[model samples]
Target chain A: MDLRPLKVSEVNNYIKRLLLSDMVLSNISVEGEISNFKHHYSGHMYFNLKDEKGKIKAVMFKGDNEKINFKLDEGMKIVATGYISVYEREGEYQLYVKDIRSSGIGELYRAFEELKNKLEQEGLFSQDKKKQIPFMPRKIGVVTSSTGAAIRDIITIIKRRFPPCNILIYPTLVQGINAPEEICRGLEYLDSRDDIDLIITGRGGGSIEELFAFNDEKLARTISKLKTPIISAVGHETDFTIADFVADLRAPTPSAAAELAVPDVMYLLKELDNKYDELKSIINKKIKAYKLELENLDTKLNLYSPLNQLKDKKIEIDNFLRDLTYVMEKKLNEKKAEILELKGKLELLNPNIAIDKGYGIIIDNRGKLVKSIDSVKLGDEIGIILRDGKVLSRVENIDEGEKIDEFNL
Target chain B: MNLTYEEAILELEKILDELESDDCTLKESIEKFKRGVILYNHCKDLISKAEGEIKILLEDEENTKEETFSMEV
Candidate 1:
């Protein structure tokens, strides 16, 4: 190596060239506590980042400084991203910060919280403002990166759970500076259509910085104002963004959002089957009850049947006939006895009986019987009767009751 | 019966209610059972006949057109 005397400016210029040539040094990120933070009148930010054993001077121009989301102060931990270069005049190496963000919490996170609070105060996330998701959505609109895992997962889930739902996808950029506008456009496109019943806007899991677009104020407000119900499914389950709060519903993942949007066909089919079974059983019960009622009515009607009443009446008539026959027999017997007694009495008085009892009877020729001699005229002839024979003889005189003994022989 | 799924379900529930009532005549109950069976079949068919279809809404310079959507995955 040839040794040559060099000026301080020449060495500084050479160091600057060396630093610029190095790609890693030109683009670097340094995380440390901010010590000397100053906002100059020229609208530039000057700061020094110091860690436990090292420190570096950092500067952000007004243009880049305006991009920072949080106010920079001393003793705040931050990650300054920029190129490392050597200043010729000062002959010192420093970080030329292009952007500064809070180290753990992140400037994007702060902005998200700020917007979330503001919108919350505005009542954009009120429950009454939320539109109920249709139980059976005919059409669903999806806004996400066309090629990301979010769309694939959503489509697969929706296809598996509920088939007939029409899915309309608005392919959009999900990150970077232009993502918010594209997302808004997608929302607006879907909102204008009357056929879409629901909208799902999301992307796969990513770093907080990668998900910054979802925290955009314009996008959040756009989601709040959409006529159609929106479900926000962004990043992982733990990642909460402004869009999540403003949306009508927040799904932990893209797959979850699809589940919430539609119902399972198998479950509905099972419910229908259960309903059918219940109806059949109920109808059977009704039939059984009606059969029982009919049997009871048959028995009741038989009790009052006309044929049964007629049979009862026939039995009563038979009983009355038997009683009448017994009374008639008794009366006939009594009459026979009285007739026998009269015959006995007539035996003392009748001619035949009197004849049998050694008494005689007389009759007139006209065949008329004379008890007191009033019926007979004592005219031509008379007859005398005995027990077994009769004889004819002439009647000489008529006998009254006192002279009846004269006829006796 | 050409009842939709929801209509069929509603009619089926009504039939059940009628069958449970004490005043329903046997003739009327039987008629309701027949109708309920028809509605059940209608609802089941409606659910079973659904085919999974995906559609994409494409916007061009002038208008939006809907087309069948299919992916390799």
Candidate 2:
């Protein structure tokens, strides 16, 4: 077969046109981890997206890159949708991405989650430590740019709903490089104000890099120390900042933070009117019921007086006294006869009669009355018992020791 | 007349909570019931309004897409 040699630029342009026209290649989704990411001055992003098997070059033009909600970092997993084309000058194929979004946890996000979980486990996010937002805030301090749309939106919504609420603006930078320190200072300023009932700190929607100030650990810790409730409103509804987790309450937007900081004045006024009417009716009913109770008591007062009860008690006492006197007099006569009988029995048992008949007792040293010579041992002390006298004696000899046996023979 | 469904729903919730609580007396309960009926009517009105609003937004989005495609062609 005969063939003609083709130039590199011609072949590349043909491939580029072919790739652009291929619908499958024009709108394709690729999943890989990003590496060697570079952002050019023109705002175009260049990066290599790789899987375990291979890697591909990718480029996101400025317009497409602006739509990314989060920062792109090396080693961050992403899913990119783009058209495939050959770069004519480099003669290399690359993906020209229209959209690139996070497919899994980026490195910074993973670090953020890790630190958040650690702090939460250490009890930093405990509900008991969270201060309650006041139901009716008198003065709300806001920490954001004085000229930014966030403060403007917050003030508008707050004033519209609750006209009486006062606002104190700390006016800190809500974005850019110096935003974190400015936010911290703003929080401190608001916290020092004794009149401030609560603080709402946040910014409007932005890229993750622009919202980085709210994700600072120092700012989050500062929010935790505020005596006034801190309501975090950072980024858009899809964005979450560290301040959101550490704050007492997290609102989806700056305007929402204002709404949460103070109750709707119209709703509150309606509730107050309802309560007032209910209280008035309750008080009126109570007054009428109390008057009726007093009237009923007045009617019973005439029939049931204290003097009537005392008169009935006096008659009962008199009847009880008469019965008591009769029973006492009968008991006294019966007791006198019993006393006389007891006196006669006592006289019959008197010892003077027995003593006059001349009976006597003899006792030894142990107080036994000895009646014979054998009753006590020789050399032992003895006591003689007589009708009216007692005598103590000691034995003179043992001659009588055999006398008892002789007398028996 | 300008009431939205979300507003009516919120009002009904408040009325229901008041009636269900022990704090309200029988007379208060009756008043809340009457207010709740008014809110229910407002909610019906708002639902009809939302249906119209959604249809309008959807048509606008469709027209914008058609216009973009024609310009591209």
Candidate 3:
């Protein structure tokens, strides 16, 4: 056969076209263990997929590598999906991997576990680091898909429980490759606003892959660093994510998170009413106690009142005056009777009365009265007076003999 | 009189605590009781006046806009 010698470039181009034309070779899945894995600074990944018998080189460009949910390492068994094509410069055929996945467990799950363990050891899940959820948040920021059921449920629950709170929604993607970055941005946006009191970040129920964005380490760290308390409400009740562990509070669903973010106004009002009744009762009791004390003081004051004491003193003085008047009257009557008896004696001893009864008085000439014969001594003259007449007589012998018969006057 | 719901509730609680304490005088208790009544009424008014309105805040490079938000189910 007469054939022209093909150039090296032509040969590589032919093989490249041949592999690209084959449908089976163009889109295939190859299962092998990853070896000699090298992540280039250009965001491309180069590795070799080795089976028990053979090995093939693979290269994943930055676009495809960006979709990888887990870090690639040597010896990890995976299934790479892409076409086998020849490199023109190297003169080698390799698999241009479009996607890679772990053979048994999902790559996203592995990534979730890996990041969870790493962050747990770093104390991002520590309870003391979590902030306290505000009891009554005036404004709540919700980070999730705006059109999804998660936001709808959160808004409904929040409105029902607390109507006064303002709900601020930060629309974000919760799944796919760009989900982690978008979610981080949403959190940052809410954090930047000073008016937001609390943050509720989450999505509705989904598969592990769909929930993988919450497993991102950077997102978890952002949640841990937030000054405003965050409530993570991801997927169903059974699902848990790294965001759940790092958040200040966790709710099984978005509605539950909304319920936790605000307080029920009706219940608070009832509590205030109870407090009001208690305060009124306490004040009444205090007033009653004071009234009783005043009454007791009044009784004590009446007992020692000066008006009552003056009444007692007046009664005492009246009794003393009566006793003094009675004693003085009795003494005066006794003195009057004694004085009357003395006056009667004086009247009986009167000489005029004796003379009126025929008894005469005798006197000497010199106006001396003689009571015995020796005192007369034969006086030259003597005068005698009877009741109404006087008689003159010469000295006469006075009978000294025989005490002169007791004269009966 | 312009007290917020939170402040009113907090003040009501303080008044209740003072009234319950033995150290409070009768005149002081009465004064606090009057204040507590006013606070309770203010809180009740706040709760009754609240109309549950949902609003969405849309912020772009140039301006921020507020629109009434309702769930489309």
Candidate 1 per-residue C-alpha lDDT over A142-257 given as tens digits, one digit per residue, 9 for 90 to 100:
99987889999999998888887788888887876568888999999999989899999999998776678898889988998899999999998999888998899999999999
lDDT of 3 by residue, A1-409 (tens): 9899999999999999999999999999999999999989998899999998999999999888775666689999998999999999999999999987778665567777888899999999999998999887878888898889999999988878778888888787787567788889889988999988899999999867668788887899889889889999999999999999999999999888987888887787778778778877888888899999999999989878998788888888988888888888888988899999998999999889988988777788888886767767664688888898988987767776766469864
Of the candidates numbered 1 and 2, which has the greater TM-score value? Answer: 1
Please, what are the lDDT tens digits per residue for candidate 2 over residues A1-409?
Answer: 8788889888999999999999899899999999999999998999999999999999999877765645789998899988899989999999999876578536558867887887788777889988888765667777887666887788778777766666767666676446777789778866886978888889999766567677777787888888888899997888998899989999999988877876665675566446445534544554566679889998788558877778888888988888888788778877888888887888777655665666445577778656667776778887655567867778776554445446532
Per-candidate TM-score, first chain only?
0.56, 0.47, 0.53
**Candidate 2: pairs in clash:** A361-A385, A362-A369, A362-A370, A363-A368, A363-A369, A363-A370
| Index of the highest-DockQ prediction | 1
* Model 2: chain B TM-score relative to the native chain B: 0.59
Q: Against the true structure, what is each candidate's TM-score?
A: 0.59, 0.42, 0.57
Candidate 3 chain A weakest lDDT stretch, 10 residues: A400-409
Best by lDDT: 3
Give the worst 10-residue stretch by lDDT in candidate 1 chain B: B46-55
| Candidate 1 chain A minimal-lDDT segment of 10 residues | A370-379
Pairs of residues clashing in candidate 3: none
lDDT of 1 at B12: 89
**So what's the TM-score on candidate 3?**
0.57
Residue A156, model 2: lDDT of 78
Stretches of candidate 2 off by over 4 Å are A1-105, A286-409, B1-73
